[model samples]
Target: MDELNLENEHELLNSLETILTSECNLHEYIDDIPQIFATDNLKTMSHKEETNGENIETLFDKFPMSSNVSKDNTNEIVTLKSKCEELHTQIERLTKEKEEAFEEIERLKDQILSQSTYCTSLGAVLGNLTWRASRFPQIVDTWLSNFQSKIGEFLSIVNGTFGAFVDTYRSAFPPTSNVEYQFVMGLLGIVTNISASPEGREFLITNSSGMEFVQKLIKLMPELPLAPGTVSLKRLMLMILYNVSMNKTGLQYLLESRVEDTLSHCLDDEASSEEMQLLCLRVLQSVTYDLDKPKYIHNLIATIPIEKIEIITSAKRSDISNAAKQVIKYLQHSQKITK
Candidate 1:
């Protein structure tokens, strides 16, 4: 019995060694084994071997590589996070700068708009002041002589501002609002009478600035309608033309504009009163006397309508009759020349 027992112990030890060796080659044996150790068999083992040699080999192979890969992945993730943070900061700064630039542009636009409005208002005020100042001739003369610089400054402001006002207001109001129209006429009278003065002649010779003012006023003349019996506007216009005719240079200026053409239109209606006819006749006679200049004569004769001339000659106002007869004499002379 003792001998048999020793043999059995030797066989059992050898079996145990074989099982340990098989477990150690777990990596190689994984495909061959259908099942690892059964739960009941593991519990019956004297020493607890929770993991096989195959499992140990798997742990050794995977642990170092997986740890190194995890470290690399962690570094990549940190770099991406830093880049995202930088981009977010740059976007925020750009957004703020864009907002500030937009606000500044809007502020500048508003300031420009405000300044434009103020300049227009100032221009209107200066125009009205000039109209007021022109009402007194003596004051104008004194201002022109003693304070020539002041006169120039005032005229500069007036010319600039009134030119704009006439352009704007004439479109809004009727052509014959007596108060406003009279003020314009009065200003023209001031310009004409002043140009006739010795100081004005000197100013014109030196500066040529007043000529610009007169040209602007003459351009504005179409806005004033010939309201019947309201002689103030027509009188002022004729006076300006008369002054223009007196000087050879001024005569050339007046004739070049063909103002005579406008005078014909003013006298078209036979219904025009004697006073209106007289004004028209006077303008024609004054313009035609300078017929010695071919340019002036041609424009003057072309401007006088034959029918209106006949009607004006028949209707006699003592003031207009003399002027109309002088116009007839000039026309007869012009016709002879044309023939």
Candidate 2:
């Protein structure tokens, strides 16, 4: 009886060892858990043992404990555990990214709201198309068309001076526009677009008061106070003259006015910006273009440094180099004159 009990105990130990070894190799045996377990021959609870030479053979083919997990089920459990941990880490990372996305969204929403409020206020005050929030530049173009139709009335209101025009323009933008620099910008927008057109160029030349208007602006240049507004105003005025000097009639007026010397001085001016220097150079180019007018050319060569002109010949600005090259080309073939 004791020998039989010992045999049963030895068989139980072998079965447990076989089950543990099978668990270790579970991954090699399993891919799909449910299908494998369903179709497989499950172990039964009936006694299963074979002995030879006092040794009991216990392996998966013979072990019978129905509750014990199959190789496929063990592998599936390990894979499911790994997948769960990966999902947990991904969820944490996604949560942080979602928080950052919401912060950017809120900042953009605030910026949009602030701009919307500003545009709304601008709309309520300036109801006319001339002063619309996005299209205010259209005001000058409209002013140019109107001025062309009623030149005398337009001249009368400003009284032939830019200062008067500036004062009247402030009423169009009103105190709410809040930018003093817009004054010069408003005036520039009108003349710049007009000056670019052939029809507009003809109008300025044919209109009896056109040169008179230009002369008044030139006369105004010397008298401008050395203040911020005046400096900007002068720059815009120079730009107007540069555009006007595109044709011979206008070029003749500049040479006859003897603005060449004044323009040469403007090139040397430290207070004025490079844009001012460029316009001054362009006007000089126009004045010197009439080879018939060598007197103005002589004055230009005398006052401006030859090296300075050379420096402009290689200037970073395309417009400056273009005008400077014209002057240099003109000088290369000119008669010898004492500076």
- Model 2: how far is 107 from its true place, Å? 51
Misplaced by over 4 Å in model 1 are 1-141, 174-186, 196-208, 223-235, 269-276, 305-307, 334-339
Best by lDDT: 1
lDDT of each: 0.57, 0.56
Identify the candidate with maximal TM-score: 1
**Residue-pair clashes, model 2:** 0
Residues 179-238 of candidate 2: C-alpha lDDT, one tens digit per residue: 334533453444445555555555665566666667766665655444555556566678
Candidate 1 lDDT by residue in tens digits, 255-288:
7777776577557654455666676677677666
lDDT of 1: 0.57
Assess candidate 2 and give its lDDT: 0.56
Reference-based TM-score of each model: 0.51, 0.47
Residue 88, model 2: lDDT of: 39
